[model samples]
Target: MRIDASVITPYPTFAYSVLDRYIDGDIIIDKSSALIGTSSGIYAVMGDETNDDFAPMLMHEFKRREMLNQRFTLFSSSERWDRRINELLGAKLQRMPRYSFTFNEHRFMQSQRAGIPDGFRLNRTNKESLEVNREFDAAYIRKYWGSVERFADKGFGFFVTEHDVFAGECVSIFSSEQYAEIDIVTNPLFRGKGVAQCVAEAFILECLERQITPRWDCGLHNTASIRLAQKLHFAAPETYSLYVRK
Candidate 1:
C-alpha cells in the first residue's frame, strides 16, 4: 500500500526530521511511515526495528522509480535493514563508517573575539555578496546548499576574504530546531593557512547566539576533518554506518 503524502510527518528519527529543513519541497512518505523518499534522489528509511517490515516493499518501489544508474545512499541504523536492502538491490553494499561529534559551546566562545588573518576580513554570506561575489566557486554553492539564493535567504555561512578574494567558507549543510550540521571548504591556495577554522569559528558562534547546536560529522577515514573538529574542541565521537550501493 503506497502512502501518497509529501512532507514527512513528524517523527523521532534524526535523519528524516532534519531533512525537512534542508529540502525546500515535499518529502514523500510511503505506507508504514518508514520509507521516506526525496525528489533530490535520496531515499531513506527510518532507522528502527519497527520500520524493518517495510524494507522489501520500499525496495520494490525504489526500483519502480526506474532511476536508471543514478546512485543514492540508503540511510539506516539496523543491520537487518542493510541486509534486506542489499538483497533487493542485487548488489553488495559498501559499508561506510562515520563519526559524529558533539558541540562544545564554551570552547567555541573562546575565540569569539578572535581576529581574522592579516589582510583578510570575515563576512557572512548575504544576498548582496551572493549576487556579486565572483571569488567563491559557483559549483560549490549548488552542490552543498542547492543555490546561492537559498543560502542567502534561509542558510547561514561565513566566508573569509583577503583583499576581496575568497579564502575559505564554513556553511550550514542543513539545520533543524535542535542542531545544524556544518560543511567547510577552503580554496586550495589558502588551505594551509588556518582559514577554515576562522570561518568555522564564526559559524559556531552564530549558532550559539541563535541557541542552536552545531554538529560535525565526517567519514572515519577523513583524518583532516577529524583533527579540525578536535582543534575546535568537538570531541566524544560516536560511530554510525550507512549503506551505499556498489
Candidate 2:
C-alpha cells in the first residue's frame, strides 16, 4: 500500500528542491506523502497533507525518527493513538510561561532598533542588491530569502546581513506556529566576537513584534549552537532524536 508522494504532491516541489540541499540522507517516498522525518533533528513534512490515518504507522515513524531513544520514545505523535502526547506536553509546559520565549513584545522591538550599530543595518530583500551580490551564500541567501518571503503574509520574514561575507549571511524564520527559528552560519574566519548573538537577539525581537514564539533549537552535540541559544534567552531545550532511512 505504498503511496507515491511525488505524484500525489502535497507541498510544492519547488520548495523541496531548495531544501534538498539541507536534507542529510536517503529519502523514502510514497504516493500518500513524503516523510521528511529525521533521526537527528526536527522531523517535518514539507507542506505535506495526506494519510491522516497514520495511527498504525505512528510507532514505526517514532522509531524511524529515533524517538524510541533506547529507553523511552523521545518524539512521537499518534492520531488517537494514545493520551500520551497531550500528557507529555502538559507536563512539559506546566507551570512554565505560556510562551516560554514571550517576554516584552513592545520592548523587544524597541531594543532591536536601539541596538543597531552604526555600520550594521537590517531590511527586507532588495531584488537589485541580490542580483549583483556575487558572494558565497549571497545567491543561496537570496533564494532562501525569497522562499521565506512567499510565506511573509503567513508571518515569516528574513533579514540579510553583510557584516562579514566570510561568516555567511545571518538568517532567521518566523512562523505563526509559535516560533521564530534562528539559523546562523558563521564562517571559520569569523568565529567569535558575538556577531551571531547580536543577530539572534535582533531576530527574536522581530518575532516578538509580530507576537509569535521564538524557538532556538540545535543538535545536542553542537555546544556552540546551544550556547548561543542560551545567550538569547532560548536556554530551555526540548530534546528529541530523529531517524533517516538508509
lDDT of each: 0.65, 0.41
TM-score, structure 1 vs. true = 0.77
Clashes of each: 1, 14
- Identify the runs in model 1 with alpha carbons over 4 angstroms from their true place: 1-22, 25-33, 50-53, 64-66, 78-80, 90-92, 110-114, 131-148
lDDT of candidate 2 over 93-203, digit per residue (tens): 111111122234444444433244345454443344444433423455434334423333343323334563432334443232334455566546545745466556666
Q: Estimate TM-scores for all models.
A: 0.77, 0.49
For model 1, the run of ten residues with the poorest summed lDDT: 4-13
Query: Over the full model, what C-alpha lDDT does candidate 1 score relative to the true structure?
Result: 0.65
Error of 2 at 230 (Å): 1.0
